[model samples]
Target chain A: MARVVVDVMLKPEILDPQGQAVQRALPRLGFEGIADVRQGKRFELEVEGPVDDAALARIHEMAETFLANTVIEDFEVKVETSEGPK
Target chain B: MTARPSPTATLNGGPTGRWNVRIGVVTFPGTLDDRDTQRAVRIAGAEAVPLWHRDKDLKQVDAVVLPGGFSYGDYLRAGAISRFSPLMETIIDQAKAGMPVLGICNGFQVLTESHLLPGAMLRNNHLHFICRDQKLRVESTSTAWTADYTAGQEISIPLKNIDGRYVADERTLDLLEAEGRVAFRYLDGNPNGSLRDIAGITNEAGNVVGLMPHPEHAVEPLVGTGRTDGLGFFTSILKKLVNA
Candidate 1:
């Protein structure tokens, strides 16, 4: 089986409230030197067959259309091969 | 397809018999304001038809309204998922064909997702869910929704949202400004740090409008804030559809 992972994050220009909330809480929790923080989301897709270059392209299209809103956010996809002998 | 109300039919708050003009209010799974939208439509003296996110048909509504709410639990960005719903597909097609459409708050987010309008919504710069009566100036009266308000007329309506900041590229913003497509602009103060105090916008065709405020909440004068400023939106569209 192949696993495709998609990561979505707000554009650098857009404000991220949840990440800011975390950054604010961390200071109270005694963490320091955090210049800034931005939150993001990740999705894992398990494909039934091997993920080839075409599969990666399809996953990218899916991410663009559904998994992430390109208007305010950007997305990246990575494919992983199973760790097994053929 | 001009939708006309029956002759000699009086529109009352009760039965509203003999009226044929129907306005559709869409309900997504997590939508929180469908009932308020329906009430506002009925109060505006039209039939309010409930449209489901999963359905493909608009039930032959003369106009469609996407009301405020946290649709799809605000997952993957607000309105991202709901925009792909079956009903929204129909709405997008119809809106492009000049069917009148209004999107309020999260519905505005959905409209942006569907590409019916430009720009995008982001979290409030203050990172808070702001709910308050807001003042806005009607900037364009040429659209189907704002005909009742004269240009520069100021009105107060409820503004509520966590993700209410509207952003777009400079070119798109300039085009919107140049074309006079800006329907409403925030007054008194910019509530959510939106670009140029833009509160709402209409499409190039002037048939679709999306904004970050809840006009449905302002229809009843007794609804706490005592503002009936939003009734103009409903009435304006009713007149437009009837005249079409």
Candidate 2:
């Protein structure tokens, strides 16, 4: 069995208004020196038994096609088992 | 070309007689605008067919309208999950085969998610849900929708959505422009920070269009902001069906 996580984030070139609103408010709360902030989503999936190379590839495909809108977002999959999130 | 007649002019009778077209309005669980869309279709002199998101068949409607609303609670991004609904599978195939499909607001997000249209929608540049009577210029009259208005004619409709800013790669934007796929664009002011001031666009075949505004809300003088700028979209589809 393997547990994996996928992080989906808007591409750097894309504008993130939510992150910007938060970034602007931080200064009012006495927090400074923060250059920027970006918002994203993280999805954790549990796979039952026998993780293999093909399984990893399939997970990557699922992240690209379903878990993320690749046109404007990028996704990274991390295998939390043998690999410490490569 | 001049714009169509006044809204009251069509109030006398939906059409001079019965129209042969049936327009389908899909209702996803969270859809808030299905009734409005059906009303618009009826006002346009067509039979308004009610379609369920869970239903796989399209009911042989001449056209389909995916109305605005928070489908699937706008979870995992607006329109993402709804794009995979059972009905959407049929819609995707039918839309690709040149069936007329108009997606408004959240519906627009679904069209993009399903790859029936290019580009994606992001949060409004101000990171808020913006609701307003937005002014838009008709950039193309060749699509399944928008044929009732002349190119460059400006109209106002209710624009409401949280994730409504349109984004696409430069190449795609340029291609859309070159191909005249930009069916509608913001006029007066760019309300949502959309690229190129685009408010709506069409597929390559022009049978599918996706926009961030609710044209359904503007089809009548008695409801919504009392402006009738959106009647053209509904009427335009009927015109196409008649001509086909």
Global Cα lDDT for candidate 1: 0.87
Q: Which stretches of candidate 1 lie over 4 Å from their true place?
A: A84-86, B1-19
Residue B71, candidate 1: C-alpha displacement in angstroms = 1.6
Best by lDDT: 2
Stretches off by above 4 angstroms in model 2 are: A82-86, B1-17
Error of 2 at B215 (Å): 1.0
* TM-score (0 to 1) of chain B for each candidate: 0.93, 0.92
In angstroms, the error of model 2 at A81 is: 2.3
**What DockQ does each prediction reach against the true complex?**
0.57, 0.82
